[model samples]
Target: MGNNEYMQNAVTGWMVPHGEHSDIVMSTRIRLARNLRGFRFPIAFSDEQAEEIGKLVSDALLNGGKTGYAYTRMSDLKALGRQTLVEKHLISPQLADAVHYGAVLLSEDETVSIMVNEEDHLRIQCIYPGLQLENAYRKADETDNLLESRLPYAFDEEFGYLTSCPSNTGTGMRASVMVHLPALTMTKQINRIIPAVSRLGMVVRGSYGEGSEAPGNVYQVSNQLTLGKSEKEILAELANIVSRIIVHERKSRELLLGRSRLSLENRVFRALGTLSYARLLPSAEAARCLSDVRLGIDLGLIEDVDMNILNELMVFMQSGFLQNFEGGELTAEELDSSRAKLIRERLRQRAADGEPHPDEP
Candidate 1:
């Protein structure tokens, strides 16, 4: 599998949920930066060693690392670990070479998360489908074996690591879905939205929304009540918001989708549809094929086109009969012919229908 294709699958297949899990995700995660904390061990582990990695991490928590999660604060390591391993120059500052590359203090669970944080500390996030599925499977596994383990252990495995406040039970897991509502939500409305979301037992923050912010537009909302609320209630709320958000988003797109929008929308839908069938080939190769088509048009050698349509086209072309093309290399004649034909067809065929448009022509 190629990188781009893998990236695509990792996003669509693993990150975005399907069927019943749809509302569980806010959106694909966008990480803008990383906060790295290095650590060194005076001694390296042997080949035969089990590498008390988990224990060392647990014991090393005293160096002022806050809970790797937002909800899990420095004062609270109960959900993740007893402590986090983010001590910089905390030990033996005088011992110069006793350690290896300091271990990067990743998040509480050590799972990479992709969210942008403005703070000095770095954060990571995983896309919704990817992480949610993982947690779901773990929860199902733990529940399946409920008779064998202790209640606390089992619950923590399913929720956000057992919390003192029972509301955060069963893996302490809460998922939020987000929407970028700049058009629907004015700056004044944003202030109101926060308390509104919080009031619904949903949490909201800046774009990128849940964990951090990125340059891209996104807003996340996750469930707040873990124990009291049944999974059904949380999921229902997520679904409702997602539905409403989709309506708002569609309206926004309608307002913004321009002359070629209909064609572009069709093109994008085609690409997204094609993506699901790409498993027959290596994913990266598929992505590259799609990327080439996109980049070709983007470079202006292929033709004048909407980049968004191009992106969507990438997904469609991946699994189609002809899935590969670079956007570079459009000759003047080719451009003129395609453009003229496109324009003429639109004027003759569907422009007068008073329908939204058949812009692709």
Candidate 2:
């Protein structure tokens, strides 16, 4: 499918709920940063040099018997297009800002994407639905091997892989899982949990990763250091930590259901009612409501609505995706209205198709 066509589609493999803990865990991602030998890092590279590196990396991956990969230059995409990609997590905010010679090579299913001329010469990434870190790592490692076979990498006898950032030097691998922790957040346990996790070489950031706010009670938990650990060790450590966090979240959820069942159910149904019938919905408010509704589904407070729709709405409600659906730039006010319309239409359709309304007995 073409880039525009792919962007418009609601379903991607990673967005679907599957694997272990799909209820709370959104997805797992593995990213490997590698720089080409004898080339300057992206920070100091000229436009010509960036172009050269982009071509070299793209050629190696697309021509090295790897089928189903599409190459798109960052400069060729409009702001909306790039923002759409960022919202979908197919590319990073940094890559979206790369309006020069930067490019991305995306697999057909979008499970794998290689960003060329980002912070490094290549940022190889693979993502999977719901707590599948091992699967993501395996795919990323396979792509790394495919590229390393065809392109020379900057490596060191001591550091393993050379990257622009010192923190990413050794394994050059960042393993992360996106999780919904509404129960913990509501119970005020997230504050304690984040610091405790950080003490264990893990960092928790908002859904879109670093430097972003966590809307919808969604957060990305990732390793903080890659300098001294092997890739296996890093992945194992992160998996263990995330599993524990999941257990904590589940416990908090049970506590909430036990002690404050009426209050929790009231909050969830109110959020669902707002989403189902509101005439105007801001992006942030929409995200918050969606989180509550998702919590309701997981706790069995509500049934019939598919979790996949909530996942899709999380991306679709973003400003860029909403504007893309409308085919124009929108003022903040317009976006709010459009977002509400989209939500109401979607939820109303589900209701029309035999799903009971939130207000129904």
Best by lDDT: 2
Give Cα distance to truth, residue 227, candidate 2, Å.
1.4
State the lDDT of candidate 1 residue by residue for 1-361, as single tens digits. Answer: 6534533432233222233323223233222122222311223333222123322332333232435532222322221121111111111111112122222333433233312111212222333332243444343333223311321122332443333335554433455444434333422444565676677677765432335541113356666666656545666675565565555544544453444445544553453333323223343433433333332332233333333332222223222112112223334444333333322332223222334433342
Question: Residue 87: error of model 2 in Å?
Answer: 0.3
Which segments of candidate 1 are over 4 A away from where they belong?
1-161, 164-167, 178-182, 185-192, 207-211, 255-361
Q: Which numbered prediction scores highest in TM-score against the true structure?
A: 2
Residue-level lDDT tens digits of model 2 in 167-195? 99999999999999999999899999999
Estimate the overall C-alpha local distance difference test score of candidate 1. 0.34
Each prediction's whole-model lDDT (CA): 0.34, 0.90
Error of 1 at 21 (Å): 12
TM-scores, all candidates, are 0.37, 0.96
